[model samples]
Target: MARVQHAKDVAAERLLSIPGVHTVGIGYKRRGGEVTADLAVIVFVDTKLPRADVPPDRMVPLEIRFFMDSSDREESVPTDVVEQARPVEYTHIPAGTLAGRARPVAGGRSIARAASGGGTLGGWVWDGLNDEVVLLTNNHVLGGAAGTDVFQPWGSTAATDHIADVVRTGTLDATIAAPVNAADVLEEIEGVGPAVFEITTATVGMPVEKSGAKTDHTTGWVEYVGLTGHYGSTNDFQVAPDPGMPNGRFAYYGDSGSLIVERTNPSGGSWKRVVGLLWGGNPELGNAKAHQVQDVFADLNLDTLCAGAFEEFLDNLFAPNFPEEPLKVTPIQLPEPVTMPLTTGPRVSLSGALLALQQAAGRPFARSRPLHRGMARDVEARLRLSRMGSDLVTAIHENRVGLARLVLDRQTRRALASAAAPFVEGVWTADELLGRQVTEEDLARFHRVARIAEDHRPELQPLLERVNRILGELPGRSFDDVLR
Candidate 1:
């Protein structure tokens, strides 16, 4: 009886048992996780419950109480998390460690209320300077907070953080906080403050913790701190802090502004420092990113509790809040996760890096007579990749970061594999996809990448510096090492 069943099949039978029940309901669905034999029960019900309380689009949380020969069991139903929280702005935000704890207007969302731990959503803050603190969040999510004040978007643009204001205007004390306007919205919104960050002297791999409304408080370790991307850009990381903790379930909605506190054990004693303010993860990955709070406070030197006077002042610079229409900044679908384990081998697995490198190579070994149609499609698959490799060499020699970024995009990465196939073709069987080769022309193209590792290619550097022990073995190898 645990197997899921058609609501219609059991609906009539259930209604027949209830004399006063005049209507029967039916539905079909596979429960979360799996369809186990123990749970394969058909859902049919005869209810006098108020169905009108919720709209057709709304889902009701039903607590099913059922028992077998031994004992009855109960399961709490779930509602779409989005419907519970509406969009909000910094104006409605408050300062605290707990996420989603703020009193969102009748219908809105708060970071204090996001999921907890690594999987939680919402913006957060960190005490930045001598007195003031800074707020953080994404630009796309700003529109939602400004418009509806509801946390409706779960998969996409749902959570946000804004600069907190302490002042009050009318009874509508939007003093808790207000939203910042990055050039995206200037004319329409009222006091608009763009999200900003302050820098700190915190080192990488520090242990940190933050509070959220949903889960209260959680802690994690830093994977990277003050990191610069391809173009010398700074970024923050908060991955699985410790080995014991499970993924997600750490923080929930409305946890934004939670502090990332790390402790340092000095020779004299141990102390804690404020590092950053929560910023939404990158759009493609949705991984959490934060603004260096230390720098933010120092930049503005604004007061935090001055009834939000600083926030009020900053807001005034932005366009008033006359949302002509709903802002276009909405969360889109998330990208697929990278689940493969880290593996290393000799030949640069250009295909893995390119994502579709094999497709690009299109090198096809000759086969016996065609046994089926569409055999023409089996021509040469590896060649396609070889051509791709040649193209990459040319593009790299030309020095085009834009082209490289394009090739790296998840969808079209195959083109890069197609370009990189040749350079890696005759590579040593024991070689792994360490990184792209450096060239002589590349010296003028991107010198930074070239400097990190000594030139293994003879043509690029005639003489290898043997002063450093790390460079000892480099010069002994053939110059062609860079090319292969």
Candidate 2:
């Protein structure tokens, strides 16, 4: 392999200078329309002309020579010429209908710099050092000085459509953009579902798939790895379209930055493991070129393809809403029976009255405490608060008091209802004992409840205070801290 690579390197520049030649790489040679096991310097050309029709100087050589320094010798390696009209970078003009605007943006959708043409979003990746999620795409799509605005659906001019900003670019034709809101991005590919966070190296003959802005989803097979194309781009792999694909093309223009993934089946389930980032291709020959995914990650210093914080957010979102069993309230036991005199004259036990009240309230009271606790920890609930708080904060921070008040009105009713359920239950229980004067045993039971409540106070207080402020019942400075 090294000998063949060295030979290709020696002959590539001279061969590429030939009139019809397009690219030079190493791959299995083909004879009589069938690929053979023999390795050769594969030359892609615009036309496969007969010797009589081509000039001697423009003719591709059958073999090339490379010097071996160790043995003080030179050796001849064979070459194979295949027809490819032209190689093209997959960007600029929109050619297909697979792209559209999406919210909570994901990969394989249309995206572009605010001032540039559109391309495919490769995927989402985590920049652990910055504690954020960023969008991955081709350099030509998102590359620029830091803070260059990016948008979805290619040419959207609305401020609300502005999604990310270019933060990093790589020599591998890769670029990453930090999203304006990390929570608005998902580590998923359109039509292909969630991608495996890890990447695998591309190998010859490996079957692969990619979802792109223009092509949507397509299958291909690795033709060659470690291939160098025009302009001296290294560490690239070539993909040949599946024979069943339309026009034998795996990718089209505007499909740049599409993530090439290998689909693997283990235990009867399929997973998409990333292999490369699509950049350029020869659509006529169905040969697409991409930088190895491993190289892309190394160049960008990325941790993983999926955001950890978003994973946590998802976990909180899909968790069960209610515990399997109802919350059992243990009655507050007193050391001795405390009799309370009723206005009717017959004496009743305070603990007995409390038990009777709880029974009267039935499942509604029994279910309330757990429901409140569950909602406090749920992501959907948190998102509600975050959304409301963000609206109010943005309004106030931007000096829009009228908007803030309107947001306050809408959020306050919901917040008060959510915040008051557990408190209402507590007050109702306390009201039952109010008719009888407070006693030593009653005071002891109250202290026990206080001690129990204190353990969970730290966790519950932030949520309560955030709700209180939204309802205009508590004075506070920032809703952001409480939401966090």
Question: After superposition, which runs of candidate 1 have C-alpha atoms over 4 Å from their true positions?
Answer: 1-140, 143-199, 213-215, 229-232, 246-257, 263-272, 280-288, 298-484
Candidate 2 is scored at a TM of: 0.59
Give the per-residue lDDT digits (tens) of candidate 1, residues 1-484.
Answer: 1311222233334423533332222112234533222322122222223556544433233423333335455332211111011112122233223223333211112332133121122231222121122233333323223222223222223435321322111111011223222111111001111111112444444565544333344566554343322112233333233444334433333434333444332321112344655533322221233445554444334322221222222222221222224337876676875567898778643323442432232211101111122211121222124453344333332322122223223233333333334333433221222233434433232233233223222332322232122223233342224232
The digit string of per-residue lDDT tens for model 2 on 1-484 reads: 7788788888878988998786788888899989888888888788888768888878888899778657768798899888876667888576566677788777888898777877999887755434345778898777757768888878786788878877777666888887765445766777776653657788778898888888888898988776666335656889999988876778888889999988673222233678999998876676689988888888777645332333322222222343345458999999999998756777665534654643343211111112223322243333445566455433322322121122123233234333323223332222221223333444344334333323333333333344445434212322234343
Which pairs clash inside model 2? none
What is the model-wide C-alpha lDDT for candidate 1?
Answer: 0.30
Model 2 superposed RMSD (Cα): 22.4
> Which candidate number has the best lDDT?
2
- The lDDT per prediction is 0.30, 0.65
Best by TM-score: 2
How many angstroms is residue 11 displaced in model 2 relative to the true structure, after the best TM-score fit?
Answer: 3.1
Minimum summed lDDT over a 10-residue window in model 1 is located at 183-192
